[model samples]
Target chain A: MSSSEDSMCRAAVDEALQTVGGKWSYDVISRLYYGPQRFNQLRRALGGITVKSLTDALRQLERQGVVHREVIPTYPVNVEYSLTEKGRDFRAVLFQMRAWGEKWLPGEKDEKAEG
Target chain B: MSSSEDSMCRAAVDEALQTVGGKWSYDVISRLYYGPQRFNQLRRALGGITVKSLTDALRQLERQGVVHREVIPTYPVNVEYSLTEKGRDFRAVLFQMRAWGEKWLPGEKDEKAEG
Candidate 1:
């Protein structure tokens, strides 16, 4: 490939990584992939993630257009998060990564067997 | 998915990210996708990467079993780097990321037009 094409390819990959490569971004995206989730539901699902981190990740994802935030008119007002079209498209990359990991990385079961 | 299954999936994705998510690891892997490369060739291709960073990234990939290093005997011994089967498998993820980026992220051309 020409140097320009190489650079463009790198740029594109970098953009994808920057969008979902945060500490808690992937975790959030993975959960939301199931369905839309309320903030508390996401917090409980992620376990060990701080409220601030989850909020930050959500906001970043929202800004990147990978996630959509909706406010429901309720007693206390609930905010739900879900993947946008772009975010849904990211599932392919996530699936591929998971598949590669399963094939190459040793799981807890494998570790136990080796031990 | 069950909580256990979710955790396992997350762990797998995390493993893949940790292996290839270094600052220059993706760049290195991208260049090597074309073919095996000498150290200097990779350094030049990567552009702006320091020797130390490149060396560290290569060593990490090597340890992770994603890259293989071979010593070629010539007038002076020369070392070359190439991807292993596991590393080649990573192309799926890379291709997906690139596709997602092209679809979602704005390129320089887009920015120029907008400007």
Candidate 2:
């Protein structure tokens, strides 16, 4: 590849990584992939994520256009998060990642087998 | 899925991320994807990686079994880095990520078009 093409590839990879590189970003995204979720539901889904961290990750995902936030008009307003079209585009990538992890990594299943 | 399955999935994802979470880990892997590279060649290929950071990343990848370091016996011995089978398994994921970025992220190409 030409240097310019290489740089462009690098830039694209950089953008992709920025979306999911954080400690909780991918986990949050993974949960949202199941369907729309309320904040508490997301928090419950992702065990051990602090309220602040979850909020931060959601806001970041929202800004990146990978997530959509909706406010429901009810007795008490409820906010829900879901993947946008752009975000849903990541489903295949996430699936592949999970598949790779299971196939390649020394996972809990292997540990159980040895134990 | 069961909670045990969820945590196991999380653990696998964690391991995958551990291999490529850093600023330069993926880039380093990307470069090494083509073939084996000497340390200096790697340094040159990845623009602006500090020597210390490069060394640290290589050691980490080596420990994770994603990268193989080979010592060449010559008049002046040379060390080369290449992707192990485990590391090469990530090529598809990285390619998908690049495609996702190009399609979803407002990248340099889009900016250029807008400009």
Candidate 3:
């Protein structure tokens, strides 16, 4: 790529990283990728994540239009979190990265080999 | 995907993120993607990155087997860093993310819209 194109690519990647680059941001999105889940359910899904951090990550994703939060009022109030269309589309990036990780990263197989 | 598959995917992603998730790791790798560069050239390419942090990031990548470091014995000794085949394969992930960023991310066009 030309210098200009290279810079543009760099900027885009920078912005992309800014959006999903947090320690838990991409992982949180991956959890929601399966389907909508309650706040507590999401917390349960992502162990080792403090409630405050997960809340912040979800809110950040929501602000970026990558996640949607729905409130349901019943005898007991309910809130569900799911990916927006844009968020669903964002999965393509994660999917590619995950595939690359599986191939290059030391996974279960590697762990088994060493252990 | 099944529950077992989900966890596997998550592990893969977690490992992937660990490999490239640092604030400057991905950016550093991206700089090297164009071609091999001496330490200083890479430092120049990535503005605002501290020398120590870049060195640490490169060392981490080298440990992961993604980056190859070579020392040249010339009148002035020099060291060059290049991506191994595995590292080259990792670019596909960055390429996909870049494409997603340009589309969903607030880029030059978005900046112009605001300014």
Best prediction by TM-score = 1
Interface RMSD for each candidate model? 1.1, 1.5, 1.8
lDDT of residue B47 for candidate 1: 83
Candidate 2 lDDT over A28-86, as tens digits, reads 88888789999999998777889999999999998888899999998799998999997
TM-score of each: 0.89, 0.87, 0.80
> What TM-score does chain A of each model score against the native chain A?
0.87, 0.85, 0.80
Per-residue alpha-carbon lDDT of candidate 3 for residues B16-45, written as tens digits (9 for 90 to 100): 666676667787788887899999999888
For candidate 2, give the lDDT of residue A49. Answer: 87
Give the fraction of native contacts in model 2. Answer: 0.62
Question: Compared with the true structure, what per-residue lDDT tens digits does model 2 show for residues B23-79?
Answer: 788879988988999999999988798899999999999998899999999969999
Against the reference, the lDDT scores of all candidates come to 0.87, 0.83, 0.80
lDDT of 1 by residue, A1-115 (tens): 7887777777878877877689998899988988999999999988899999999999999988899999999988988899999889999888888888877776553786688
Task: Report the C-alpha lDDT of model 3 over A1-115, residue by residue, as the tens digit.
Answer: 7777777787766666666767788778888877998989988888788999988999998987789999998669899999988788888877887787777666544786788
The Cα error of candidate 2 at residue B91, in Å, is 0.3
Q: Relative to the unseen true structure, what is the C-alpha lDDT of residue A59 in candidate 2, on a scale of 0 to 100?
A: 94
Q: Candidate 1: where is the Cα deviation over 4 Å?
A: A107-115, B107-115
Which sections of candidate 2 miss by over 4 Å?
A107-115, B108-115
Candidate maximizing lDDT: 1
